[model samples]
Structure formats: structure tokens, C-alpha cells
Target: MAPPLDTRSPSGPAVSTLGRSVRQAGIEDIPAVARITQEGPLRTDLDPESAARSTRLLLTHIAFERGALWVEDGVDGRIARAVAVVPGGQHSPWETVGRVVAPDLARVPPGPDADQAFRTELAAVAPRWVLSEISQGSRARPGPPTLLEAALSWARAEPGWRHGPIAVVADTDAERKAAESLGFAERWTGGPPSPWWLGVDTDPVAPGQA
Candidate 1:
């Protein structure tokens, strides 16, 4: 198993970002992960069936791919936040789920733009790193920086960290803004009918820069 995520740099510059307690999740954690994600910040137009299907696909992939699923503990002794980390080269849960249906247009309220972004930006990425299934529980927000640090920790440990890019799929406006503040570039933007897929990319050298 991979080591727990910590604030360590890829190269010489030491990452002093205080670490958090992260434990590798087992089969038992699947239900909690699923429940939290079901209540996550997904599109409002999304029906319960679609939501359940999406969650199922995402969690299944996380377990099957041996990807990293970090569940942070809340002050109330419940799940705070949960995120699924997958290598850039591998198939992101969003990618798989998207194959079944589009994001923005699927439900109408939030059409298929999110799915489009995943197909274009994430699917076309060159073996880098991906952050998906980012959800927070009823507990206090962990702040975007901490979530971002968890992402970087995975990259810092990647063998190709030096030359690789990082991508994140944000499901809502808030998530998108946090990524933008972190220097992540938007992947797509156009006129009507295209839907707004908030795909973000960060530079390999700076990691935080677009």
C-alpha cells in the first residue's frame, strides 16, 4: 500500500504543510463513502437514480483500481471530506460514469457540460494525476488548501512528478472557484449548448500554476 499523504515536496523544497490523519479505507468504508458522496455537491437536477449510479461507478472504480480514497475525520466524529485520487494515465471515475451519460444536459438543470469537460480534458491527459469524487460531509469545511495539499501529496510521490501535469474535476461552482484560486486553468469555455465543464489544469513545474 502507498504511504499516507503528507506535506512533502517532490524535489528539494520541503513542504511544511501540516499533515492530517489519513487511513487507508477498507471494504467497510465503502458505504460511508457512498453515502457522503450521495449527499455531495452534485448537480441539483440530478435524479436519485442517476446519483446512485454515479456513486456506484465511482466507488467501484476506486476500489478496483487500487486508487487512493482519503476520508477525513470530522470534529463531530463523522466523515469530514472524501476524495478519490487516481493516476493521470488511469481512467477516472468521472470518465467511466460519463460514458453512460453526459453531465450538463443529462438532467436539464445542470446539463452535460461537466461530462464534456471530462471527456475532452481529463480523458486526453498525458499520464499525469487526477483528483475526483471530492465531497465534504456536514462537518466544517476543511478549506480548499488542505484538499489541494492532499492532491499535491499524491503527485509528490508519483514517479513522473517532475514532468507531469495535474487535473481536477469540480462538480460545482464553489469547487471550481477554489481550483481557480489555486492557479488551476479552466479547460473549456464556449457559447450556448456546449455546457460549462469546469475542468482545471496545473503546470508541471509550478504545479499550482495554470
Candidate 2:
């Protein structure tokens, strides 16, 4: 069975577009939160149990005060999208972004490893934030970009996160394109450890330029 959900309140006014609204997630939002993350189709070759476990393990420790999660609710009251943007201090989570996303992390059962990976990277990155997970739930494939923009804009507004750079690890072409288009520069890519595409957005910039 999967872990249970929590109860949280909205952090601020909705960043709404049409009937869609994006807002910071809190502890109470856990059910919808899990639905958003747990239901995403896994690109890796992993069983459903493992995928569910992986999601549960990561979500066990949420930093609500940090604006760690964002949810976009549709007009019909269904959650349309979600993103996990955690706090990163001196180290970049993108360094191990590849291995981290693997569905296998749940096999550890105890789930400490996955938790440690997040905490460890959270402490080591230079930026104040890490764009960890982005999920568009049982909705359309192409989601409204403003939802993401709102989440990002919220993160950028944080005082500490602005002091350094904001980092993300884009695992797919779609993710990579989105990050790049939004001004995240590709820092590097490597697979000897794990296939990872690391990026950093110190400040927003035009797509074509550095």
C-alpha cells in the first residue's frame, strides 16, 4: 500500500490563468500532491510498485516553508500539474539528478537512501533552490507554461535563493527544452556515473544568448 496524505493550506493567492490556478502546496495537500507525482508515467523500465514506492519515499520529507511544491488546479477541481522545487544551498542536486530519478530508489524499503540523497544535495548546492520534480497529471500533454512561470517566479522572489543560482536537472528532451527556453544554462552532461544533464539559471536570460 502507499503512504497516506497530509493536510495543508494555500500559501498565497492563486497564480491563475483562465480557470487554472497555481499555488504553493502545504502539508495538507499531500493527497493531491502524491496524485500529481505518483501518477506520472515513468520513462525508465520499472514496475508499478517500485515507482509508487519511489514517489512515497521522496515525499516523506517535504519542506513546506521553502515553497517545495506547487500545484496547478484545473477548472473542474482536479489537479492539473505539480512541481517539486526544493532548497539547495552550496551543492547542486543536478550532479546526481540521473541516479536520483531512477524508480529503483524505492527498493531500499527503509527509504532512507532516497531521503539522504535529497538532504545531502540540498546542503551541497550553490543555489538556494533545486527544481526537483515537475509533473502534469492525467491532463493534456502540453500544459500551460504560465503555471511553471508562476512557480519559478515565486522561487526567484525568495531572498536567499536569489543570492546564488537556481539549478535543475532536466532528464528528458522536453524537460531540457523547457529549462533552456526558460533561461537555464547547461552546465554539463555525464553518464559514467549516471546520464545527467545539469543546468543552472543564475538569473533569467534570453534563450539565444548565454
Candidate 3:
């Protein structure tokens, strides 16, 4: 059976204007979410079916806690982008439990052990914040307003949920601007001018809040 739905009030910090909605993703939403992440303008190549299956499995494991897939809809209610927020636990990285998304291999640091390297690099960049990297994918569509609104909405729903500070690896000035508008600061430049770490401090206002 699928996990129960979360109907509690929004947690964490709150923001305005962006229409945020929560839904328990059924088997049907998998393909759509996948398409948005892979084929959408963001050009994320992750397979929709695989992602959907992964989400379902993850949900099964964390069935007791508050969890949901967040969707940002366009004017017509079509899903512009979506992200899965899971509880922090053994399977879910302690640093990424309440995150809108997690870092993928694309954001892995360059070294023999990429995962360790990535974490080490992330620590150096923002020692105070736990980092979660966002990359371009089919489901990463929507403008900056949509992304920020969605993120803040999720945060507000789980005020006490802990997660790594969000980060984005943008390749262009336009991407940097968009990330900055969402409260990410430039932390460090990466190799070949591709991966630039945008520091996403969880506590943009109060220090030590994140």
C-alpha cells in the first residue's frame, strides 16, 4: 500500500505569491514528473519511470513521517516542475531530509571518490550550511519565481525539518542571476567553467537557524 498523505500545516519559513500545492503522487504522476525533469526546458535526462519508481520505494520506507511530492503548476494547473521532500533518516541523508531535491552525480566533485570529494568541497564552500546541489533536468523547468516559491512553500510546511542548505550548479550568468534571486550566493567556481556552487543558506535571515 502507498503511504498516507500529509495534511498538516506548512512548516519552516513562509513566502508569498507563488501558488504552492501538495499532493501524494500516485503511480500515474511518475511519467509526467519524469518528463518534466528530463524532457522539459531544463533538460534533465533522468528517466521518468525510474524516478517515479524510486520515489514510490522511498515513500514506502519513510511511510510514517511527513512527506509529499511538491508541484508547481502553471496558470492552467499543468505541472511546471516537481520535487519530492522526504524525512531525514538513514536512507535520506541527514543533511537533505527536508530538501526540495538532492545532489546528483552531475554535481559530484572531481576526484577518485566523487561522493566524498563532493561533500568535502561542499563543506569548504559553506562550512555553516549543509549543501544540496540542483542541476538541470527535464523537471527543473519553471522560472526563478516558481522555483523559489515552491522551495519556500515546502520549507514553511515543515518548520522543524532539518536539511542541508540548498545549492545550485549553474553554468551561465543568467542561471547565476536566477539562483541569486532565490537567495543563493556565489561560493566557488568549478572546473571548465561549468559547475559554479551557489550557496543556499537555509537561514537567509537569522544566523544559526539552519
Candidate 4:
């Protein structure tokens, strides 16, 4: 079994103004989180089963750390409408960006090997904050702004991370545009070992305002 969950509630005021239920993802939410990402704009480029397994491992890694995986409830309250992964730690986001984009990581079987791969890469990744992923479901309700609002709120409240750089990776032209509309600017283009575009925004909205 995974370690005990941090009972310290996720920092930041609730974002209910969006008329969506957004909260930190728990162990039980793992499956839905996996399914949403597989069906969303950011593809793992894997088959259904593989993608689910891989995403589970990744989510498990985040679930254990100070980082957070926030999910918005669908119209049917029980299902996840969208997910946003906000990374937090001392390591720089640039250090582990390559490993995060590796296609082979998605193929690792759901076992000790997969756990090790995820743990290793995740340990090296600590950013002031990274909107690591923003995936939507078919019936997605809340948009990126709501998700980002929660992230920015948490960052402002977290020690040693107030108002620092926020990074986001874009996997398509549409995603790139969305990031731009949200105030992110292109920071890097893809190269070997990294297949996605990187965008950075130094100024994001504060808590309760977005």
C-alpha cells in the first residue's frame, strides 16, 4: 500500500465560484484521473490499458509528495471533469522535463519497475510550480482558468514559492494557444528527448481573484 496521506489539507481557498467542484485528488480518484488524461488533449500516445497503467503510476508518485493533483468534478459529481497537476519542490522544473516527455515511460508495466521509473523521474522534478498537465473530459465544465486559479492560490500560500515562475508544457497548437491566452509565453521548442513545447508565465492571478 502507499504511505499515509498528508492530512494537512491542500492550501488555498476553494474555487467554487467556477460552479465546479475542484479538490485534491486522493488514491480513490486515481483511475478517473488516468482515464481523463488518456481521453483528453494531452495524449500519452499509448493504448488504453497501457496509458491507464502508466498514468496510475505517475499519479501515485504525485500522491505521495508535497505536489498536488487537482481534479474537477464532472456534471455527475462522481466523475472527474478535468485534472491539473501542480508540481512543487526544491528541484528546478528544467532538470526533469526531458524524462517527463519520454514515450517509453508510458510503456512501463504496472509493477516495481514502473514504480521505480516514476519515482526516479518525479524525485528530480521540483518547480516553483508547474501546471504539469491540464486534461479535460468529454463533459468538461470548468476551464483552465479555474484550475490555474487553484494552483496560483496554493503557490502563494506555500512557503518558499510565493509568486515564482509557473511552467506549462503544450503538446499541440491548440494547447499552445490556450497557454498563451492564459498569459504563458513560449520558453522552449522541442528537441531530442523532449517532444513538447514549454511555456512560462511569471505573473499568474492570485488566490480568490481568478
- Scored by lDDT, the top model is 2
TM-score of 3: 0.50
Model 2 ranges with Cα > 4 A deviation? 1-9, 40-57, 90-125, 136-143, 190-196, 202-210
Q: Write the per-residue lDDT of candidate 1 for residues 1-210, one digit (tens) a residue.
A: 243223321112222223444443444555666666555355666676777766656564543244555555555545555555565554453554332222322333333664455456556655355664445422333254555555546555656555556666555456556667666787754345443344555545443443
Kindly report which residue stretches of model 1 are placed more than 4 angstroms away from their true locations once superposed: 1-27, 40-57, 90-94, 97-114, 136-144, 189-210
What are the per-residue Cα lDDT tens digits for candidate 3 across 60-106?
34422344454544556665555454433333342342223432332
Residue 193's lDDT in candidate 2: 28
Error of 3 at 58 (Å): 4.4
Model 4: per-residue Cα lDDT over 1-210, one tens digit each: 123566544432445634567666566766776665555344356567765686567656643254566666655675454334445353544323322322223332234543444344444333466665444412233245555445545555555554456666554455566567677777665543433556777565565555
Using Cα atoms with residue i matched to residue i, what is each candidate's TM-score against the true structure?
A: 0.60, 0.62, 0.50, 0.59
Write candidate 2's Cα lDDT for 1-210 as tens digits.
112333444455777788888887656665566555445444455666665555544554533443466777879977765666665542344333322332222222213454454444444446665664445322334344665566567677665544667777544455556677677777754333233456678465323333
Q: Show the lowest summed lDDT stretch of 10 residues, model 2.
A: 101-110
Please estimate how well model 2 matches the true structure, expressed as its whole-model Cα lDDT. 0.54
Clashes of 4: 0
The segments of candidate 4 whose C-alpha lies over 4 angstroms from its true place after superposition are 1-14, 17-19, 40-51, 78-81, 86-126, 134-144, 162-164, 190-195, 204-210
Record all residue pairs in model 1 with backbone atoms less than 3 Å apart, i.e. clashing: 103-111, 103-112, 104-110, 104-111, 104-112, 104-113, 105-111, 105-112
lDDT of 2 at 45: 57
The segments of candidate 3 whose C-alpha lies over 4 angstroms from its true place after superposition are: 1-3, 6-31, 38-52, 55-68, 83-115, 123-144, 161-175, 192-198, 206-210
Ranking by lDDT: 2, 4, 1, 3
Whole-model lDDT per candidate: 0.50, 0.54, 0.42, 0.51
